[model samples]
Target: MDFSDLNEALASESYDQIGEICDNLMLQAASEGVPFQDEWPYAVHLLGHIYVNDINSARFLWKKIPSGLKSSQPEISAAWKICQKLWTKDYGGVHESLREFDWSSQSQGIIIAFSERYRKRMFELLVSAYSTISIRDATVFLGMNEDDAINYAAVGGWTVEPNSGMLTVKKAAVAVEQKVDPGKLQRLTEYVFHLEH
Candidate 1:
């Protein structure tokens, strides 16, 4: 796999394209049949998790990692720890550990790709936990400025009151299952799939 393409994709901010490159690199590395001495595969896969917000997939990958490298590889180990914390909803631990450790080499492809997403996730967790929180508290937790925090909240579909600088999250409504009309369903099933606009 060419590292140059990864760098170009990062420079162009083509994140989805980067996932393809990461997957190809990982597959190529694994097919070589050598002991995994490099942290590249783990870094790419974990970042794939961060980009897509699929903790379950990340957990599965972590569990499948070779036992010898689980403790020996620093970056991979850290990524696993982060995934574990994410699985447990331990945002505080995730934040602290990310602060203490550096995943610099993975920056061009993965680390930079997921930085903002991670902050937004922390913001989401905070909003879900509290009925209402000040923009100040949110800024500190998410490591963003007041204006950015408010903007983030707004983009996240949260209610931010300008008067008091507080963001409020409305409790989500429960989903109700509705039964489909049997006649309509039968008619639809009789035909080939139709694309809905």
Candidate 2:
């Protein structure tokens, strides 16, 4: 139950150990009557924002939020500021170009090229930023060990499975029957329990 111990466990990078640690942590939090369900929505929102390259805007808005107002009021003003900045910096010329140029006519003339490599790199950056907290402190906050926290993150589409030698939750889910497969549950349970011992 020690936060310091949990932090140490997470730093080890062993997925199984992490999962076990998170499972116990979650159980402990529940025993203390902490309401994790309430936090789930925010977590999902964070995931989506990260997936879509919105982390920078989110961070900018976070910084603009007044210390007192931030906690007491909604962050709509901060979000507005971020939107204004993004529009001015990135999309400012787009409207004018579209108006003056034959952008619409030319758009379909050739493939507007984009790099899969670049997109993947951007996704990695977003995932790295998202993992900074969720893969560590947020997991601790949620009372999960490293592995369970990582698993939950994967389930939420934050991380990709290894190219080989790992049974990803998605793969396991697809291989099973019923709403929640008992076999997969057992596998996860055994995995966590083994790490604890």
Candidate 3:
């Protein structure tokens, strides 16, 4: 399914339907005999970014008010509550690490250091989120095969052998493209959609 569609569903608060769709998607992946844990970090990190950045923006626009609005303002008051909770609880260290990293230089040391910190926290968030759902459910949510899921989870710099971490999403994507079947990835992507479509 498209990210926009998923975001729309989330905005509409159709969580139960979302859960069912995710469940079915996972079942399809399971049938392929792929494990699911690997992709968990990617999914969590993506979701965390969505909830924090995009959702917050939408909530702000929907509220139709400037920063002068009081906390009691109806527009974004509720949303701010949820966003604050997720930020403080779910993705606590990521923003901090991003600030700590020097983004100016394209040095190898800078890249490796940032990636190591980012991936570790991303993995931790993924594991925490995954524990809340069944393997079947997670597969559906990510729309990836069980194997792809595990591969994604097995991501992080430390998870791989030294000098093999790759250290960036672009690099990881290239590696997966080379190693994984394009057709399989497409199918997995499609599977993440709600069957109702």
lDDT of 2: 0.39
- The candidate that wins on lDDT is 1
**lDDT ranking of the models:** 1, 3, 2
Every candidate's CA RMSD? 8.7, 21.9, 22.4
Which residue ranges in model 1 land beyond 4 Å of their true spot? 1-11, 17-20, 24-40, 121-131, 134-197
lDDT of 2 by residue, 54-88 (tens): 65644543453445554453333323332343345
Best by TM-score: 1
Question: What TM-score would candidate 1 get against the native?
Answer: 0.56
lDDT of 3 by residue, 1-197 (tens): 22343345455554324433444444565688766533322222222333334445434333533444434333234334434534555343333333343332212222334334444555554554433333333333333455553466455321322343221221222233458889998888788765547
lDDT of 3: 0.40
Model 2 residue 46 CA deviation in Å = 14
C-alpha lDDT values of all predictions = 0.68, 0.39, 0.40
Q: At residue 139, what lDDT does model 1 achieve?
A: 76
Which model, 1 or 2, shows the larger TM-score?
1
Q: TM per model?
A: 0.56, 0.19, 0.21
Please give the ranking of all candidate structures by TM-score, highest first, separated by commas. 1, 3, 2
